[model samples]
Target: MHDTTHHALQRQRRQVIWGLTLIAFGVAYLLQRDDGDAVVRLWQYWPWVLVAFGVNNMLPPTDGRRFVDGLSQVLFGAWFWITIEGWWGLNFGNSWPLLIIVGGLGMVLQPLAHRYFPRHQEERS
Candidate 1:
């Protein structure tokens, strides 16, 4: 019974995330329709989608793997945005190594997270 309730909650969370995502896209579409230049501006902000997804993944009930995945997404998204925007004189050519570093961080952190924050056996099942 508990498992069923948990599953239902998870499903509801996922539905909420997807619904919000759809609404966001719809609003963007409307903006684009109203102003053609909005499409160009929106294109540059594409990496924010990854950040949103990452945040969604990090929501409650997340485990080690999910948390690591979310963290990587957020880091990568922010890094990509920074590189594209050339903030602080950083660009893809010079800042690409950060991607590798982020990957390594995720790899290193996942096991440690799991070790320290093990999930309940019931949750696992």
Candidate 2:
């Protein structure tokens, strides 16, 4: 039952991943200018974004309680993006949406993980 939902969600994400094509195109334009500020900023925060993305993909199948608890306590992806930007006092501009997108993806993953892989146990009466 749950496996079907999980597979469907993964398929949906695979489709939405196309949106990132625009990111590459935009970056190419920025780098073409070769502005030092643009280049340095790109190098600085890009890794964090990548890390968030990786974590999102690898979120494990676990009890929904653990998943919800962790996500609520720690902000990854877009949440981290906003925190880093705010700490540096940079007005979050275009990248602001990434935070929600990334963070929300984790939320999405949590349910999917739980739906697909709920904690296994003996049936309780």
Candidate 3:
């Protein structure tokens, strides 16, 4: 029963992710048809994809490792996006160290997260 529930939840998560992806694609397509420049501008937001994937990984029932991985991805994506936008004078040249920082933080946090909020074990059917 636990296995079944886990599988069902996984399936539902996949469906939701795919559905949102399709909708995004459809919107992009419509925007492309209406104004090519709009689509080009939209392409600049690609970093959000990484953030979205990170959020997905951190979804409910995920293990500490996955959560940490997701958190790193989210941080990296946001940092990259900010760099690209030149926010606060940040650029690839100066901001590259942040990637390493985020990785180190994730490594440290993953063990602590696991120790405190252990993963849920699904029983075998």
- By lDDT, the best candidate is 1
lDDT of each: 0.80, 0.51, 0.79
Please provide TM-scores, in order, for all candidate models, with all chains considered together: 0.81, 0.36, 0.82
Q: How do the residues 1-125 of candidate 2 rate in per-residue lDDT, one tens digit apiece? A: 25456556645654554456457647755665667666556544553544434443445532454455445434553345555567655445645665566567766777565675454211110
For model 1, the local distance difference test gives: 0.80
In the predicted model 1, the residue pairs found to clash are none
| Tens digit per residue, CA lDDT, model 1, 5-121 | 756766787688778877887888786887878866777777888888888777766667777898899999999899889999999899989999999999999988677546633
Put down candidate 3 lDDT per residue, 85-118, tens digits, no spaces: 9999999999999888998999899878777545
